[model samples]
Each structure stands twice: as C-alpha cells, then as structure tokens.
Target: MFRLLIDADSFPLGKGPMVMLILFLISTIFIFARSEEQGQKLEFWIFANTHFEEYQTRVPIFEAENPGVNVQLINFGGTMHDKLLAAMLSNFGAPDLVEVEITSIGRFLKGAIDEVGFVDLRPRLESEGWMEKLVVSRFTPWSYRGRIYGIPHDLHPVVLLYRDDLFKAAGVEMTEVETWDDFIAAGKKATRDLDGDGTVDQHAIVLDRRTESDYFSLLLQQGGGFFDEEGNVIIDSELAIETLEFFVSLFNEHKIATPVYGTWHGDPSNFAAMQDGKILSILAPDWYVGILKSQVPQMAGKWKAISMPAWKPGDRRTTTRGGTMIGITTQCKNPDRAWELLKFTYFDRGGLVNRYETTRIIPPLKSAWDAPIFKEPDLYLGGQPLGELFIELAPDLPPRYQNPYWSEGADLLNDAIFAAVTEKQTSREALTELAAKVRALIAKDQGRWRDL
Candidate 1:
C-alpha cells in the first residue's frame, strides 16, 4: 500500500517535480467513474445528458448522509421518450425516481404511468407541506384527467435573449418589444454588419420554434390545441391560419431569422449557436441562459433576457416552454431513499444547488425566489437582477392546455415547421396538413376525440 506523509517544507521540494511529471502522464487517460453502487441496489432515473457534472457534487453528500442505500443513475440522452414508451409497453419501465418533461407529461400520465407504474406524489407533497410551496401553475402540463401526476423542478418560459453590445453599436433603443410586429422590426434592424465586411458578421435573430403552426399555440398561448373540448381538431380556425401565415412572414416579409437558421435540423438550444455568434437576438426561456453559461463559459456576460414578444400592441407578453417533473416509481424498493434525493434536489440546502450550484435549473419552489441568494444581480446577466424579472413574469403565465396528444403533436408540428422553413411546402399548405394529421391522431387515441 502506498500513502502520503505530509511534510510541510521539505515535501514540496523533494516531490514537486515528480508529481508534475506523473500528472502529465496520467492526465490523458485519467478515468474517474462515479462512486460505485453499495449493498442495496437503488436505481435513480433522470433525463440528464449534458449536466452530469452537477449530479457529481451531490452524490457524495447524499451518500454520506444516508448510509446503507446505494444509488444508480440512468441517463437518457436523445432517445428518452421513445425508450420510455417501449419500456412502458413491457411493464418493465418503472424507475425508482424519474424525471419527465412537463411539455410531454400528458402522454406519460395518460398511457404509461397513471393507471400503471408511477405513484402519485401529491400524498407525499401534502404530508410534507411541499404542495403549497411548489409552483402549481408550472406543473399544469403534467395534470391529466383532473389528477395531479407530477411535481415541478424548473420552468422554461420563452423570453428575449439579446446582445446588448450589438444593440448599442447599432444605435437601436433597447426596451421591451411591444408586440410581434415590433419584434420583427427589431430583428431587421439588428440583422446588420459593421466593419464594411462584404459578408454579414451577425444575424438579427433566430426563432427555433419548430412545430405545426405550433408557434401558433405559443403565439396564441395555447398548447397546440389539436383537439377541442368535443375532441375535434380545430386547425381550420382563422386564429390558427393567421398563426401559420405569420411564421411564413418571418422569412418572406421581415427576413429576421433565415430560412436555413429557422430550419430544425439539430438542437434548438440558444446555448449551442450563441457561441458561434451567428445571431444577435433570440426568443428563449429563463433556464436557457443558465445552460449557456454552463456549457459555453466564454459568453458569460455578453447576453441579457426579456419577455416573449406579444401578438398585438397590448397582448400578454409570456408563453411557456420547458419544465421538469419528478415522480416516484411504483416498482421502487426504497422510496424513502428516493424521496430524500427528490426532496433534497427540489426543496433543501438553500435552493442554490437546484437553481445555481447544480447547473442552470430554476427552483420550482416559490419561496426560493424571494430568498437573498436569488434576489441579487448575477454576473452572468451583466450584473442584472434577472431573477426578479423572471418572478414578475411567472404570475402572468397562461395555464398550459396540455393533453395526451402533445408529444405526437410536437412531432407533427416539427414536420410542418421544417417543410415551411425549408421551402419544401408553403406555410399554409403545411399547417393544413398538420391540422388534418392531428385530428386523425386524436380520433385513434383515447380521450373525448372518439365521439368527435
């Protein structure tokens, strides 16, 4: 066995050169896997692909506090939804703890978890008095058939993320975009090049909202309402049609986001493209900035955020985007241990780790917002108190109209958006097709669409 003897002065003088040479040789192949599982096998499931490091710092703390419990974390990168669906069909998909995206929670609740493998978290929340503190409105997407099925973790509301330095260089007034019309105008002005370069140095904006007139749902503040109360697809409405035409106008008329840039070929994250400096402004969510800061640490203080653009002069300036739900599996052998992790992840330790320390997740607890840590100006946001602005917009969020059809509906919408943005089909024609497809999907699936 080899060990270290701490010698204050002579140790460094004797071992410094040797340590440096050893570090150089070992650095290339250094392998540090997560702590190994202990005696009891406890599986913890989450949809963490990029933020694995955040979980690293929490593991030792949790394991030390609660002995005799082993932890296993399952990460599903791009195939999370598809894999879960397959596992559900076989009755073998139950994880001790699972994280579901709120946007697609309706599908999991209706077909996979509600009457099947997942247990209701409401009882635990009520017994612990966490229900009152959690953001109720943030979790409406997970509610199906009038039952609370999931708990909120972080919410991604579409907002304005802009380059302030560019705005200043262009001599453009930086303020809240009054309406979509004004936003489109701002995109045109912001999409300019300086330094007399023949090629454009920066673009005006990038709108990555890909879905079947789905931007219509966000624009209309509806969750792509493919089925009505009577369960019939209503894509033929004038409001829906207007939504389609407006997306096309973004390319044909305004020329803000390029057809190629608006095209959905890869991830829509503002974090990915912001570093390349392709676009100057984007309509993004609150947590998006956090993702940027963590992944591309270089672009730390160059960005700022604003509320989503309004449809008209005085319309509401908010729309929902991303959020997460943590649930306990019915197959869990150690729910108490799982609950500890869930509670600690969402409610304990001053909410910094969940909101800040653990990466870019926004704490779902309302009280966390008012805390001194969250109230201060952040260096990443150019010393602006972005948390205050985010909380101010929280109450203004419209209740999400989520249903089982949301996931497939998102797929259909993605197709339509791609076709229109890439000029494979006109916006009107693509949305018309999307509306027709969604009607058929609803008719075949459960829900009131059967009668309609």
Candidate 2:
C-alpha cells in the first residue's frame, strides 16, 4: 500500500486536467460530426399513394434484396400536392423519391416540382436503353416538357367496376352492355329495390362528377380537352358541352343514378360509395382493384370489371384515367439509388409482379401484362383477367391531363357538373358557369391560362 498524494488545488496537475478536457471536447465533436455526416436513417425516404401500407410490408423484402438498403415511407394524405409542397419548401422535408399520380404529373412537372431537385431519367433510360423495354405509348404522361422526368409503372385504365350480384339480380350482364347506351339501360334495371320497398337502397350507378380528374377521361375520350397545345382552357367548346350533357344524363334522363350517385356530381367518390355497396357500379382505374380487394374483401369474387365504352364506335378504346409516377425529388441525396427503386417499383418487371401479387393493382408497364399475376383470372373479379383488359386498353389512351392549372380548373368544373347532375343547377348553367370561373382562374394565374 503506497501513500496517495492529495492535490486539493494542485497547480501542476491542473494543466493535465485542461489538456484532457480539450481532448475530450475534440473527441466528442469529432464523433458527433462523423455520425451526422454518415447520415444514418436506417431508411430511404420514399413517397407513395394510398396503397402505401401494403407496399410497406415489402420493406423487409427490399432490405433482403438490397442488403444494406432500407426504405421508410412518409405518407402524405391522399393530397400529393399539399404534402409535396410542404416537403419541397423545407428542403429538409423533401423525400428521396416522390410517387406522383399520373393525372397530376403534368401539374407537378409544370409547377409543383422543385426546380433543382429532379434527376432527369432520360440519361439513365438512354444509357441503359431501357426505352426499348418501354412500350412508347405507355410513357405518354412522362413525356411532358420534351424530356422524360419520371418512370411509369402501368397504364392504369379507368374501367367500370360493378357488383355482379347486383347486376345479376337486375337481370343484366356486363357483356350485354358494351356501349354507353346499353350501360344506361342496364343501370336502370340495376337501380331497382330488391325488397320491393318504397325506398331504393341501392343506386344503379355512382357517378362522382366531383372528381374532375376522372371526368377528364370521358372528356378526352369524347375529344374534349381542358387546354390547347399552348395551354388554354377549352371546356367551352361544343365537345365540352356534349361531355357535360353525357355526364348529367345519368341523373337527368336515365333515372338509373340516385342522389347518392349524382349528388357529388362533380366531387365523385366511387371508391367509397361503390366499395361500401351504396352503388352498383363505378368508373375507376386498375389501381382501384387493390382498393376494392383490400377495403371490401367480402365483396371479392362478386365484383366485375370492364373497359370503358367506345366513344365513337371504336375511336381508340379509352383515354388515360389516373395513375402514379415515381420521380426522384430534387431533395434526394441518392437519386441514382432512389431512381433504381423507382424503376423497380413501376417500370421493372419484378416491381410490377410484386405490386400485382400483394395489391393486385395493375402497372402501366407493357411487359407485366403477361406476368402470371395479370393472367390469373381473379376469383373476386369473377374469374376475369382484369389485367388483360387494362393492357389492351392502355395504348389507346390519350395523355391524361398533366398541366398545373388543369386540376385547379377541373375542380371548379366538377363542382358545377356535380350540381347539374343533381339538378341543383341546369346542365347548361353549370358548364357555362364553370367555364367562366375557370377562365378567370387562368387569367389570374397569368401564365399558360391566358385567354386564347
């Protein structure tokens, strides 16, 4: 046992203490700086649409496949614009990749996108010659601004979804109603009350006119356009009038649709009402199939789907309805890797297969058409190969509206269309009013919306 030397106020040892303190501080800062620079999130930031939860389950699959790669999702509401804007401005809020709806791609491409944060996928496409893999027709929306900005997954056609049981109970079959005229007649039959009760518990059709994006499909199918080549509102033309009239006929003339179907005329919610069995049929994209299966599993095997009716005795089959695109946001730190995931999720065969297997949502890509998932006749969809129908229908689709103000004008137009369908406003009054308001909005935007 040696005697300990006590230093109460030791002047000599104090220098040692100072040196240790400085060294400790330096070490602490070095460690912290290094940890931050490494940027460990144990995840890759990705944005997605409503089906994210189902996709998230595959994270383990992604990690297993990519080794160290891990992905995490930041779900913004169904509203991509609002969420994306919040993220872009924060710069810190930006996700590595953004999943944008195809219908809104033009808008995002034109306005919502952060000018700095995008990786032009053209180089990748050309270098890899992935363009050969793509059916050029399927890449329509991604072609805006003369450059490829996003990778497309599937041609999500807006098809008709109907309750087979309801259609059968009404003594009608989808095959018999190939044209719009026949559809109305069948709808009238399906509109009846099963119990012979006074009140009609089920509506024949649910037309959510409030969904402006959806309505655009019919408009474009009918040769109606929201804007011209230079970008100006074109909803006031005779075609626009005819489109509105057709939209309203479900309520005004056919008597097949009830208040539930026509009430939201402009603001459609076929997914909600149709899935809930409040209505017999709805018009939606293949993306809706997954929703139908997931939300109303009980209705599986009972629901059926068909392509949109021919516009002019086969003037091309149908127009593009709605879909999502995977683009690298400007805020992304790992665009190359993020784009790889993007290509996999939408354009890659494996990604398409996974989406179909887990969610049954058809991709817009061409090759996936032959994938076993698409070929499988869905028991829920009455053994129908819904995937084939979408594939055959995709090439004929016109460009889905992709302009920034298109959605804005559409929302206003739908409000009016909905009102007219429900008899809140006459058809003429509604369309005219909508056109005027949209024009005003365009004028206010002072960009592509100026008068023709």
Query: Among these predicted structures, which one has the highest lDDT?
Result: 2
Worst 10 residues of 2 by lDDT: 38-47
- Clash count for each candidate, listed in order shown: 3, 21
Q: What is the lDDT of residue 437 in candidate 1?
A: 81
- Candidate 1: segments with Cα more than 4 A from true spot: 1-41, 49-52, 59-68, 79-83, 102-107, 110-114, 126-129, 193-201, 209-217, 220-236, 259-277, 334-337, 352-354, 422-428, 445-452
Clashing pairs in 1: 160-306, 211-413, 212-413
> By TM-score, how accurate is candidate 2?
0.78
Give per-residue CA lDDT, model 1, range 262-345, as digits (tens): 344124544456666767776556666666666677877888777767776667777766677777767676677778887876
lDDT of each: 0.65, 0.67
TM-score per candidate, in order?
A: 0.76, 0.78
lDDT for 316 (candidate 2): 57
Q: Could you list the CA RMSD of all candidates, in the order they appear?
A: 11.8, 5.8
